[model samples]
Target chain A: MSRALDRTGIWIGWAFFADLANALALTFGYMFSRPVTMQYPDKEKWLPYSRYRGHHFLKRDDEGEIKCVACELCARICPCYCIEVIPYEDEKGNRHPAKFEIDMARCLFCGLCEDACPADAIALGQQYEFSSFSSRDLVIGRDDLLGKPGKAATGGGVVSARLNTEQDVLVETSEPQGYNWWRNIRRT
Target chain B: MELVVALGLIVFKVALLIAILLLLPLPLTWLERKVAGHMQQRMGPMRVGWHGLLQPVADGIKLLTKEDHIPAEADRFLFKLAPILALAPPFVVFVAVPFGESVSVLGTEITLYVSNMNVALLFVFAVIGIEVYGVIFGGWAANSKYAVLGSLRTCAQMISYEIPMGFAVIGVVMLAQSMSLLEIVRAQADVWNIVYQPVGFFVFFVAGLAESQRIPFDLAEAEGDLGAGFHTEYSGIRFAFFMVSEYAIMLLTSVLAVILFFGGWNGVLVPLPPLLWFVLKVAFFVYVFIWFRFTFPRYRYDQLMAIGWKVLLPLSMANIIITGVAFL
Candidate 1:
């Protein structure tokens, strides 16, 4: 933003002082400013807001059991045909999935499955970090998708959390982290 | 017996100076990275050792342990010697750099400096000028085109800037009426040379930046282009030597500026030890040099030439004339 061939004494003094002052001010300003990087699984784990369609989580009743009625509405609505469900009746007349399978590799992470669930049992929850080693791991079964992993999927927008190393989960702290990228990505 | 003791003292001083010079680059590396990081609104280096305090030491260890790689077509002899040549002059330059006046220890006086010849200022400049050969040799020895170009740029840049850098100090020399750096400091006991020769100080600093191959004027080893410049083919300890010498040159510039313009060992406000004042002033000047690295952009080759010859050269020349007229 400066010029060359300015041999005037006044120009030298003004340019030098002005530039120095500007640089010093900026340097000091940034020096004290906070960095906008997420530590992630080191110091703080990110908690995606509600309505985020990350990994699938089966909704639970008050007693913390699956709310799925084996209605097969989610299987019918899935665009990718990634879900499979087999219906059976309990002695109490409650309906449940005898064989439920989801091929995560083929799933598009669309919220249609959550919307079509009449029982409000199946949902694409905000549990994003579910990456595993092999193709077999991508094909999750009832045991894999049952209990909601990590923190309770109930926070909004953005949250920071202390890492729970032993169970490999996030312990949400009271600090109240702020930033939002919820549903920023959409599947056409 | 007396002569033996005198010779022993000289050897002891040389040993001490070398140790200090070798260790100087450790904290300097940490400071430069830390400053650059903070200015850019990021944590600089925190992993290695608390804010990367042990980073340079770790770097030195890495360099030391790395395989010594040499290009197949390179001049092997010159390649080995270049780093030593580059490294020795800055070490030698310290001979004339007076840290403080003689301090007595148990009835025996020991000078803070290794040696102080009457022509100490001249000696310092002349020795520093020789470091260009080290850089030139490094580039030429590598037998690479980019290395050659980098070396040539270094040679030309130093030659052009050296004139102004040398002349900038003439104002201080004239005002002090002595070429000895110690005497120059003594002359500025009450009033610093910076008051009389602001232009000279400016010229000296700018030219010194160029001389040291610091960031703004660091065309020789410009990391962006030319594949790391002259020391491109160099690796391990040899490359580390070049790096250390560069830091040493920057340190020398700060030390010289303090001795010449800012009044070395002369405290302003509070009463403190002379060495402390000298160190504190030198530290401030060194920080300014690092500040310039992060603050300003690198100059284009032609722009570098223009600044060196057109602006600084003439400014320093005019400074000399003005100082002469004022003296007369």
Candidate 2:
């Protein structure tokens, strides 16, 4: 009975007061502290890393020619079988893709296709904002892939061509530097 | 002519109070989500309007448009009546709550509350008691084992907690020497009741939380175990009504706490109006309620019962004795 009384006294007197004090202190501390939320869209769009895999794109040379030589390697390496490339000989007898399509719905944003490309002609761009209404709208074509402005575009083109020796050309152009494209997309 | 005028004034006050009660929950729901989000390092519900201010409006429209379903084997009448039963009591209780001291308008003194009865405290308690019936009916009528169990637990919890709650209020009533809510507020003019009756305040706060079925006492709607508990079968506007009533009850409890302990409308040399001070105090308590919801984990069913019966009951009883002896 004495032990029970002791327990009750401790609980009613010490435990209750201590818990209330702790709760009040923690609440006041949090109330004055800065919220960790970034408040996306209203404040500023949060950007992921530059190497973040997003949309697929076909690259262009310094002369603005399609760099894809219809290698069929990207389509072969694609796990989702989303990429379709048909190579045809140009008037200059140079190999170029006549029909290149990437079904964004099927594309897993995996960088395997980007890694397997011998010519560095295809890449997963940093532009993740590709939400579309229709499934057909998500299927990106060769023209749309090439339509991105050369200077602003990053990832989906020949940033580094292994076979072409356009390393000097790649250096001359301002390489898409930081992970700032996400913020840019939000404003527009 | 005088009787007609008095009736018209009463109708106007009731209408105004009802409008405020109905509209208050929208912003409060938004605030709850915002507080919860900020505390957890996320911006919650920021698409509809500036920082998702219009989220509750959109939610209301969505609920209204959605299909309302009833279980096939459920008791139809009770199921339909349960939401109204749940939603009405909190508003009824609000009529007794004095928002501010009497103020002169158009050369006549008018009280800010809808109505102030001599036994306002008893009226508030009586109306609040009716609220649990709604939950019980909702759970029972659903004809599900989980729903029945949820309702049973709620019934047990509310009843047990109400004892300590009543005893705590009795301590306040003893100090004030009156049951009227306004009288209780006036009694605290010199110093707030919290300074004198700290234990009573603690018991009252905990019991009030249990009565409202908030976190740490939300076994009635323990979603993990009971799948939305009593309201599992309810959907659409009916569900919205349940949610709105819960928030209203929360608001009412905070207001009552302010009146009982913190000296309602009493402030230290503030330039603001008394009504504003009252509102600010109530808002602080409301924010604290949301903070507590996020801070504490739900109590176990058995532990909740033990706290109510063992700790709060005896503590409140002792507090009443202490207050009586001290006053003597």
Candidate 3:
């Protein structure tokens, strides 16, 4: 009678307990599976997609002369009313801004200003760091935005230079980095 | 002089046990984070010390230095007492826990546990139950909606699962014919209680998970929706106290499982010391709990209740009946 009872108990456990056991086994297998988190800044900075909109910077020609004509097309088209421009014309007929400023605190980052600019002169740069402790500091001028792509700046910084290709050179969120990139991080 | 020496030994044992229990959470937190990190194939807490071994020390210092804030609307008295209530009971439960058989030192015999009451299991259950009051008081005192809801869930969850947990223990009690934890371990000399009471162990495991407010049953820690649940108002040392209670409770559950089922300190095959075997077994279960935390998603509130009341309670009742009849 006791043997029969024991058999029934085993059958009950076998039928009912298999699913929980199966789940545990499956997850235990994944204990050795690859972690997808790419440690940013300390490791690989996620380079934004080409044509990715970030902080703005003024363009320069070959002689390092500022390319902005002070036509104020970007300032006019800005949706957030964050841009301020004071046009200046040099004695030699060179056109530039006397005091050009964009309050990044208020700016929408819509990339519309990039589209409005003539020949992409006041185009948005690949720099991502725009935060400042004070609102006064956030109102960036033309000089502050020139040739600076923040600290993660390596070729074109966090933003890609060229448009994205079929085989993505820039690591997009869609792909998991299954390489030995983490090994390069020197143990502190 | 003899009486004084005996009194001194008791005091020494109590102090040592308290110190060990208090310090245990540091290693446990480190182990938990490492387990979680590795289970997901990442290194957790590697910055502070070697493999994040000193991470808990860094965290303790950080928590200690933080600003202590109490909301203006909160009940000041209950808010102060809540974390204490939560933390103290788990330690109190330790007084009755049978670590192993006695050891002789300097010609004086010293038992491992502080006290081994004949009804130690009952004492453990009864005292540990008081831990919920801490949750309730903390939630009610916070004067926040999330805190209250979190506390209510913890209360209902504990009350519901406590029944099945009781039944699970009853099966072991019936099999061993004793309520003492040490006696229960002694009963499982030749064969572990797991072989005879598999269903009891299953029920106990499920209910213990709920009791500790762990994953799948940790609907109370509704970080997703309830914004840290009952601890939304807590910060710094106050929060640390609650965390200490949580780790202690997890340890307590692991210890119980070892004593009740796995033949406490009974070595198998390898001739390792009994204390080492016992510690290894407890460590294994602790890892299993951490494994479960990462492995399973939190059950919905309704699902948690359903499992507690509809599933485990009935299952444990059946287990009790079967164990009784089989033994007879």
Candidate 4:
């Protein structure tokens, strides 16, 4: 009798209960709560206390000069090796990089490259909506690679520890990805 | 003046629920894409709205503008009729769902529901059962073996699950002593059906999932094997209607579960209002469904059937017996 019960009884019990419970819980418990979506550019997303990580861009100087000295530190430090920089001499014998490229596709946003940069040239900025039609479009040139100086980063890879509060930095340190799987999992 | 105001409030409440439910599926589709994208370590739907919130809207417009294609060999009437028939039945079900209790509207009493039939529960079940006809017709009209087979599988799965679902709901009816959903909810003022009949809750939940044709039970549109399943030939706004119906059913099932198991907005202390608590509970289950969709792989057709038959049906029958004995 127990065996029969276990086979048929258990299955039927779960079928009925789980279905009703799931439905009830969603409708009564959470569905009617204010939907978490905010109208973007018009309304700000209350993104759980400084967890918003925007697009990855390198930092620029106050005078709008590219901070990335083409030090090749970002390239060397990148795990995916998506970053490529060519340090060349100009006609005036200026030892600046002739070609600088950062492939956004392969970037892990690990921020190690920013950390490795000696000149404080590379910084991942806020502006996470980096979308493109082709792989070629996603690859950032030297001019596009840099972040704005002294700007409040909405949150993403390689944010300045100074701009963020201690707790925010601590959280960021704990979760290097900034937006882990859990935070992004919005329950509909 | 009082009657007009009361009627207006009822209309407003029903409209609000319908509007919210209708808009929900679009975001669900977007979220599915984003979740799938992140899971695969690739960004999905980056362009349209911020993080693709507007992606569904774009898709809606795009689908609407697309050409409606019907094969020459297909039965023209049913081909045109299939998606609509498939779509309309589920959409019609919200008429009976009680979203909240009556409140004073312009000094006139009003109910939060559109319909208050004594047989509301039966009406919902009967309507849902008829939804299969939509699928069958669509499949038969398509003139493709794949579509026919897909529809047949869907019919079998939906019909098989409905048994356990119906039985599970019976347990709640026994306790509430009424088939009327509002009365059932009102019956659980002190104790929820869930506290006494957990087994019934489980059976109903699984059956509901299958009924919604969600993941783990979504053999209806098994893309890899069925190539969009029964609606393979459907296009344009017609296809959109089918999609809308699917999400609507999902929302409806969620609402039903809340009503039956979770005390249906009956709490010890009504601090923040019962309605608020009700919505929170419903959202939790919706998230779980989303979570399941994200986390689990689709079940094979045979395995799904075996589980429904060998497992859910019998278990629900026993649960009814258990509930009966416990009450006695």
Among the numbered candidates, top TM-score falls to 2
Query: Candidate 1, residues A1-188: lDDT per residue as tens digits?
Result: 13455546557767677766787677666666665444456545655544456778776789866789999989899999999999889888888998789999889987898889888887775566666668787888887777544223354322223334434445454534323533332222
Task: Look at candidate 3 and tell me the lDDT of residue B159.
Answer: 87
Of 1 and 2, which scores higher on lDDT?
1
The collision pairs in model 2 are: A59-A157
In candidate 1 chain B, what residue range of length 10 has the lowest lDDT sum?
Answer: B40-49
lDDT of 2 at B208: 89
The C-alpha stretches of model 1 lying farther than 4 A from their native spots are A1-17, A34-42, A49-55, A61-141, A150-172, A175-188
Residue pairs with backbone overlap in model 3: none
Tens digit of per-residue lDDT, candidate 2, span B167-230: 9988899989998889888888889989988899999999989988898799989988987878
DockQ list for all candidates: 0.45, 0.29, 0.35, 0.04
CA deviation > 4 Å runs, candidate 3: A1-15, A43-46, A85-92, A149-154, A158-188, B33-55, B58-82, B102-110, B132-153, B219-239, B297-306
DockQ of 2: 0.29
Q: Report residue B203 deviation for candidate 4 (angstroms).
A: 0.9
For all the candidates, what are their Cα RMSDs to the real structure? 5.5, 7.2, 7.4, 10.3
Which model is ahead, 2 or 4, in terms of TM-score? Answer: 2
TM-score of each: 0.84, 0.86, 0.78, 0.64
Q: CA lDDT of B232 in candidate 2?
A: 85
Best by lDDT: 1
How well docked is model 4, in DockQ terms?
0.04
